[model samples]
Target chain A: MKIFQQSSEFDYSWEEVSTSNWRKYGPWNEKTPHVIAVDTISRTIDPHTGILRTERLITCKQSAPKWVLSILGGQDTSLVYETSYVDPAHKKVTMCAMNITWSDVLSVRETCVYQPSSSAPDAKTNFVQRAEITALCGGWQKIKNSIEQFTVERFQQNAAKGKEGFEMVLEMSRKVFAEQREMLRLQQESKILQEARI
Target chain B: MSASLAPECNQVKEQYDNCFLKWYSEKFLRGTATSDECESLFKQYEQCLSKALKARGIDSMLREAREDNRENDAEHMRPKP
Candidate 1:
């Protein structure tokens, strides 16, 4: 088994960061352009705590080496199942994801957490991500080692691109949010002016 | 907005996503949401998506994954800092 971990900070509030997560995989992200679709499978809110839970499936185009592709029957796409929990009261978001395609040969499980920075709770968000990759190929220790090494290298590269893409999406979400707020302010001002004339 | 995995479900999925986004930012995050407002749209999208999942033989795998991960589910509503 191979493990990978990453920690970083987003220069935005936790609310902003979490909200942007929903829009992270669109065309705005050129760095991680392999994402093709994201489908919400289920969603529910805990009535008592107001915490929201969502299940989603993400489809992405795979780019494995020719040999690996051949081993997997030349499949070109992979599916990932992800589950997320948003605790508004605690101001934290946690997501867990696992690959569904080719699970018999390789297993990749990942977890991510987003919370307010401990030092600057109001202004910054802390992001932590971890992944565990295991080669399920039995009786072929050499093949397993090679597959693990290759996957780790690819995982590292993808992680970097994923962070870059997420930042772009965050910026886009912030702009849209700001525009909506501005529009609401203008409508309120117009309403006040009309009331004054009456 | 992200597209649904199945092309046939895209329209209904979009409707549900828009509704959920509004509720998430304006109500759910703000502690003002009283009830879910997108359930019907979600059901509509689910119908289409389930067919796609079944066709691709992913539905059973999804069910198994969910069960395996149940024990590792995130702890909810931790004390605020």
Candidate 2:
């Protein structure tokens, strides 16, 4: 099943957006509580290409509706072992492979691209996310269909949550930047004061 | 939804993460990418994360993936003659 295929734009540069997305973790919404945790098992950087390879253990809480859960027959939390290739030069992160066990069984390959928005006058990043979901139904067509349907619905929910979470991360990044700038300004001011006294 | 695999690393990881985010947005993306303010914190966090991954038996998998990545890198870098 092809779960999510969407493009969205953010008010940040492609590099900023890509970096934030690469390190994302935690709950997207407080009320519904779809939590995501990522543990980086290993990270390697290729000296020649500057590409980063990251192996991550991604645990995601499936807060699917009761009906969907009933159809899927899986644990509340899904564990995915994913290998991601992060190409900073191209502003792209590709989940080249992912193995999901202990839930609505599936294997996922996804890619996300961050680029300048052609339509927007202001500098903005256009994010394109695409995923291919294959159900591990062990040859049962009925089960496969159920799993596929559940995945499509889940992807929809996740896509909305992802946008919200991205915005929050961007806001946090802005705040951090402002705080750093303020600190540098104060340090400069103090240095000038000390120089005058000297 | 995701918490750090190593709860012990969370503190340093959060600190390093905040620093990295600020640096990435303000410095790296803005063309001043040669800063090392968060280097120490990142190293500390990585140490903790490494221990956690070992505890969870994920280190082996990571090693295998890294090897594969290295092979792929080598293949890509090979001279085309």
Predicted model with the maximum TM-score = 1
Runs off by more than 4 Å, candidate 2: A26-32, A64-76, A91-97, A120-122, A186-198, B15-47, B54-81
Best by lDDT: 1
Each prediction's TM-score versus the true structure:
0.92, 0.71
Please give, as one word, the docking class of candidate 2.
acceptable
Taking the tens digit of each residue's C-alpha lDDT, what string does model 2 give over A67-157? 6566556466755666666555655555544544432356555556566678862468887888777776576788787777777777777
Give DockQ: model 1: 0.59
Tell me the tens digit of each residue's lDDT in model 2 across B1-81.
246756787787678767865765566445565545777887887898888777866667556545545544454333333
Q: Model 1 residue A18 lDDT? A: 86
Model 1 chain A: which ten-residue window has the lowest total lDDT?
A: A189-198
TM-score of structure candidate 1: 0.92
Using DockQ as the measure, the top candidate is 1
